[model samples]
Target: MTDCGCDKAKAELEEYLHNELCSTDAEDIREHLAGCVDCESELHVGRVLTEAVQRACRETAPGDLRDQVLLKIRTIQATH
Candidate 1:
């Protein structure tokens, strides 16, 4: 339980876990997470969500949709 309750920090922490922040800002968030259990749990959930997304992506390539997108891109390139 932080003095301010860590809600804003948790939001920034999710971005930090995703590596979406600049280096210095990410380091600041990492340091905050190190000392805060609440923030750390939020960071862990973000990591788990990311891993799940990667696993799901690997399992399904959507070949038919991919081919359609590629064909559309080729047609646009040919036109331009």
Candidate 2:
């Protein structure tokens, strides 16, 4: 298996992180990352940022804010 090189690996890193790449492409990235410290570090950073974003997405709005937004939506719907 040839190393897919840093350019392709970095370009597809996000897709690889999200498991959106086909197996062949993912494998190429995996192999490249295995031998390349810079790409591996980049992958680590991507993992961290993804995790942070996931955590942020999982958080709910404060109760009062949620209620206010819902009320506004309902009012707009009522008028329309």
Candidate 3:
């Protein structure tokens, strides 16, 4: 919907991090991030936050969290 393409880039940023986005889509976002300081800063923040959360999760080692989450997802999926 945005002509600047920032909107699409922002929308796909998380997926880009997770390797869920197609190569072409990721490439487009990369291009935008390269030229756009605003998007680049935002991407940097997202990366930092993602790393911090991952580090915290590694430190905490919540034993039942994964199972609980999967169960919840399955319950939701089944309901849908």
The clash numbers for all candidates, in the given order, read 0, 0, 0
Best by lDDT: 2
Tens-digit lDDT track of model 2 for 1-80: 57799999999999999999999999999999999999999999999999999999999999999999999999999999
Tens digits of per-residue lDDT, candidate 3, 1-80, equal 12338888788889887888877777778788888988898889999999999998878536699789889999999999
TM-score of each: 0.61, 0.81, 0.68
| lDDT of each residue in 14-70, candidate 1, tens digit only | 677668888777777767777888788887888899899889888955899989999
**Residue 17 lDDT in model 2?**
99
Q: After superposition, how far is residue 79 of candidate 2 from its true place, in Å?
A: 11
User: Regarding lDDT, does 1 or 2 come out ahead?
Assistant: 2
Error of 3 at 39 (Å): 0.5
Instruction: Give every collision pair in model 1.
Output: none
Per-model CA lDDT versus the true structure = 0.76, 0.97, 0.82
**Listing every candidate in turn, what is its Cα RMSD in Å to the true structure after a full C-alpha superposition?**
5.5, 2.0, 8.0
Model 2 regions more than 4 Å off: 69-80
The TM-score between candidate 1 and the true structure equals 0.61
Point out the higher-scoring one by TM-score: 1 or 3.
3
What TM-score does model 3 achieve against the real structure? Answer: 0.68
RMSD of 1: 5.5
